[model samples]
Target: MTQATAQTRAFVTGFIPAIALLATVAPAHADLKICNRMSYVVEAAIGIDDKAATATRGWFRIDPAMCRVVLQGPLTADRILLNARALGVYGSSPIPQNGSDTLCIAPNDFVIAAARQCRQGQTAAPFTQITPTQADDGNQVAYLAEDSEYDDEQARLAGIQRLLVIAGYDAAPIDGVDGPKTQAALAAFLKSRGLSPEIVQSPNFFATMIDAVQAPSSTGLTWCNDTPHKVMAAVGTDDGKTVTSRGWYGIDPGKCLHPDVTGQPRQIFSFAEAVDADNRTIRLKDKPLNWGGATQLCTRESKFEINEQGDCGTRGLAATGFAAVDMSGGGKTLRFAMP
Candidate 1:
């Protein structure tokens, strides 16, 4: 995900640890488990304190109805921290399950020290101190729950529905209850992927669905990050009538993401910039690594979808150039590469 270019650090004397908890009771051991009891598929980061020094690591993916052992071995940590966010495939980012302890994290999978303040190319976010219920003062479980309060089956179903929608299927009202719509969407997805109907019960189904949603389709706009660093992008559309701009889609190196651009807009525009591990715009000889064009559009430092095209500064938005795309063909793919 495109990390907001903000960073800060403050060591807290009181710390806590969080990991994915197991749905079923885990075997007692000196280990930690993270279980996903929420509706949304989430990725989590964690921090650990071993009485001497604190270390942070993560970007662990946990699907609904599932649990993973993120930390193995002796559980001697006095305090720990966790930060979790929904998958970006869902149009806008879902409000994260967070706490008040602000900590540093990298844009991608990482493991770093928690002592020094974050340096360049790093961003800081508030992490919640999660204490898993312990058993025999040994094994522990941390359950990830949300307001939805979905049970195991419901969370699994809802997670599937969420991914179906992102994959451009027509499943809605993700209430976790199975209905004809959910079934039809599943059938269609299976047929398209040449997957067997029985695969629906496969252990890797969610991961498979995740893979399907990120591939560049031949029918819409796609952004591919071919650079060494992470790239963030925005899109503008004109339907021969009203025009709109939206963005901040984070594209990791070597990955392709199809932004939610629905319907056939007469014209499409795009803008992108590559940033380093610290979230700073990468520069080559003082020039920032970027892609854009002559079509100017209003944007902001945060996530935005602006329509009013005039006097952007007056409206507290920065006007940025967006390049028009030649989508004369059915689908178009924009690739970002280093010079």
Candidate 2:
């Protein structure tokens, strides 16, 4: 998603427009920059196809309403690809803002000169080809927006709305505009934290909100990464009538996340695997490392919500083991470990 005014690029930060800095105060050399106009902080990877070869590098963390120069130096690529993912704060990874070209990426920050194949430790994801609007100074700029088509201010509000929902508040629309619903939710959130409403606009608000979302909740299920490596997890729920599954929530070491689930389900299912820095599933004792049980469900490599559990492979999904989560009491905690 790209948007810019005719002669100038539209963008972010308080009181100061990002484009102003680019136009008036840029470095001597031309560069590639991406501005976040989305509701969540995002980690972006770029794929450059120049000459006859392609390369991909990534995990550039851009906060809401912020911009980062991804590729420095003069541009040489005929084609550019992007795969921007919302931070893990949303529980299940949100559908990546990506493109058609499948490319290899590492779990950690990396530079892959040959982006075609996935070596042992790397994983592949579709990258969207982008044509950044070229500035007069020869720099290229791109924007990442949610479905709402947010501007800098709207993106910040939408980001707050998302975090509010994650923290168990009842914010609505998530469309950046401040309305009754958002105001009410904000008031409640501030009150619950025993914080002054003044803190809402402060720089520390996101930090406070992040802590709230990461903390355990009294309802639903939480997955904790107790392992040394990162763990990707999925959850499924059954209410007797229907069984739905979704997955690929990346949990960082020692942190916890609560996958968003709805309604009171009769059963809950869980599956997770520990992965090394390059996004490869770890192997131990010559076995694929994973945490699961006998029950199997359909899952794909990317972020997905599966409504059907049968004939997974035929539907272009992988059938993976899922253990029945014992939710006899209200909320439950599932820990992923190296074992």
Top-scoring candidate (lDDT): 2
User: Candidate 1, residues 226-338: lDDT per residue as tens digits?
Assistant: 89887778889998887889866777788787777767899999999886655567778988889999998997766667877889999988889999999899888888998
Angstrom error of the Cα, residue 22, model 2: value is 17
Task: Give residue 230's error in model 2 in angstroms.
Answer: 1.9
List RMSD in Å for every model shown.
5.3, 8.8
Task: List the candidates' TM-scores in order.
Answer: 0.81, 0.75
Report the number of the highest-TM-score candidate. 1
> Which parts of model 1 have CA positions greater than 4 angstroms off?
1-30, 50-53, 73-76, 87-92, 134-139, 238-242, 263-267, 326-328
